[model samples]
Target: MPTSSPQPPPPADGLLSAARRNLREVAHGLTHASHPPTPLFADAPRPWQRLLPYGVVLALAATLIPVTINFLISEYGVPGGVAGALGVAQAAPLLMLAHRPLQAWWIVFPADIIGALVLLGYPVATYTVWPWTPPAIVGYLFLLLALGLRETRRTSIAVWLATGAAGVVLHVISPGRSNGSALLLPVLGAVVLVIAAAVRERGDAQRRLAEQETISEAERAQRTLLEERTRIARELHDVVAHHMSVITVQADSAPYRISGLSEEAVEEFGSIAASARESLAEMRRLLVVLRSDGTEGERAPQPGLDRLQQLVEATVRAGLPAELSLAADLGDVPQTVDLSAYRIVQEALANVVRHAPGARTRVSIASDGEHLTVVVANDRAERLGSPLEPTGTGHGLVGMRERVRLTGGTLDTGPLPDGGFRVAARLPLSPASPSSLEDL
Candidate 1:
């Protein structure tokens, strides 16, 4: 055999390319307006609760705006119009922080720079904080908190770094000014970012866990469905395959058993035997497909309505008082419907016994020429047990529904007003035709 050619080595990214990619990511994070706004009073039930955040923001604005404006005008000798504009710019973004934190930061960061520049030009008080005033610091910190809560860690970190960088630039332009803000804002913002990011991560983890649980539940249901279908197929094979085998054997022995048969008759018997054999072979293939690994075929014959009385008596002995009200003349039910009816009643009784331990139950089977109706209903449990018991895998109903569906029937199940449960299934008595099966 010829040796395979060696695969080409993957190309590596250069330092310049890596740096460019990182820069592009940072720029995109800063510019993109895709982050969802954190919900205000997300778990609150009342309208007032929903408006609480807005009320807080309004209170802060009412206090900070006039104070900032007065400080800018009185302490720095800035023009009144300029002072009002700066105050509004710094304070208004705080209101926007709940819904639009990054955009608010964009506004407040530049305003702080300009405020610092203007303050640099005028006389400064000895006790005044430089670059970022008290109100400005408070508003920016709130904005940082919102950004950390809603935005990605990468984006939040970029904004945090950018804020520090702006503070540093203001410090550089105004030498001999207090640079405490340069250190203070970043440190305080870092702490806020860390806490908010932790909360965000926890929320995301919880959502992911819930989603995973939902997915697992769906998968389990689907698996249970397939398993139930396979079980039905296996039981049907046992019922049908037996008849086919018998037909084949009888057809093969017909020529010998009967005396003075014509050549045509002998040939006809052979053909019948051949057809039956072919059917048996097909059923065997289907059974093979339907069986799971290491599952042995059920050798015993499947139950029918004849066994319903026994099942109920057993349930009655099992602590549930169940009465069987089977019709006197149900006539001849189709084999599939017979098996399905038996299984439906069996499962319903099993449920009552498992869930409502001491409940009174009624199992009724009726046939009206065209259909066979099975109803298994139970009154409320007298025992100290919950109807929604956690003992079973909850696949009993699934199996019953599957059986009813296969028989081209309808099933209804629900809780009664008396805190009891009921299961009713209507199955066709006449054998289903190929066309009807296809329709089903």
Candidate 2:
């Protein structure tokens, strides 16, 4: 689970920061590299790109250091060949940092040491530069990046100061070079790099924070949607159930308003009307269960084997040609098994009506001292050329399957060989260790 936590971003100059923000976007795209965005870096960066920043800085330092050495050749009055070789040696470490940043840790220290040694050598060289513009800031800057990038600040700072002292030594050794102001250049470079590092870390933090905000917004939206759906379900269930119950009671009382009726005959007719009203109420409540609000948890009736006959009556009224059969001699089936059997039959028949209208339907419910079975078979659909379209989303079948499975049962649904569709489900008889507590 990749968690989204708030993060502060890195900070640098406008251009560097702008570049880095763009880079962070690229980095985020890279983060899901297991599923990369673009074709190339979606995996990982090419070797060179990973090394470019370190490479460029080191290359620039190496280039500058030699120029400084060439400018100072005369002041030291050392042999030209010896000075030239010393300059190349001084620049080489900086160049190496480009290809191998890890090596820069070792290289940065030595470069600082050499520059320090050269500063110390100034007394021996007997040299002087009146205006102190020591370009040796290059060594300090390299150390800054080393420490900043790698979090090796203490060692970097110590090396920087040491080499800085050596650079001062070089001037003091030269004749008439009594002044040592060139030492400050390395100190300034160290400060700049420290500031730069802080800026970088700050920007990274900010980008992470922005991502957190995005995720939080999405979650709030999801919560709101769920709440709204629950409210709607509650309202629909309450309103429909209340109204249908009222209508059912009213219909049952309707025969009393009939005037010229024989007392016994009227009583019989009223009795029949009341039965019809009760069945109608049950049908209306079933529709409410299926299509109205999903909230009001206990408002929906729990239909099970007790309600099987009602389900059959409802189907007969729906214009389906149906024959329902049940076998006796049933053992004690579990409550969950009994409930699941009824639901499977109910959904199977509903699907037949929706997908195979005007078809002959057969329903069977049986318990044979072992498993309880419920089977619904219907003729092929005239409209679809089959009871189910090949491209069905399968949710109805899936729901039926789930209900059966949850109750320790198995269900199968498919086209029957004889130009029809059949759904059969078998649920377990009473649990071996029957539950004493009512609710599971």
* Clash pairs (backbone) in predicted model 1: none
Worst 10 residues of 1 by lDDT: 385-394
Off by over 4 Å in 1: 1-13, 36-56, 70-80, 257-265, 386-394, 433-440
* RMSD for each of the candidates: 4.2, 16.5
Candidate 2 TM-score, C-alpha based = 0.37
Assess candidate 1 and give its TM-score to the true structure: 0.87
Residue range 259-350, candidate 1, lDDT tens digits: 99999999999999999999989888888888878988777898899998888887766667889999999998878888889988888877
Residue 155 in candidate 2 has what lDDT? Answer: 39
The count of residue-pair clashes in candidate 1 stands at 0
Best candidate according to lDDT: 1
Clashes of 2: 33
lDDT measured at residue 417 in model 2 versus the true structure, 0 to 100: 88
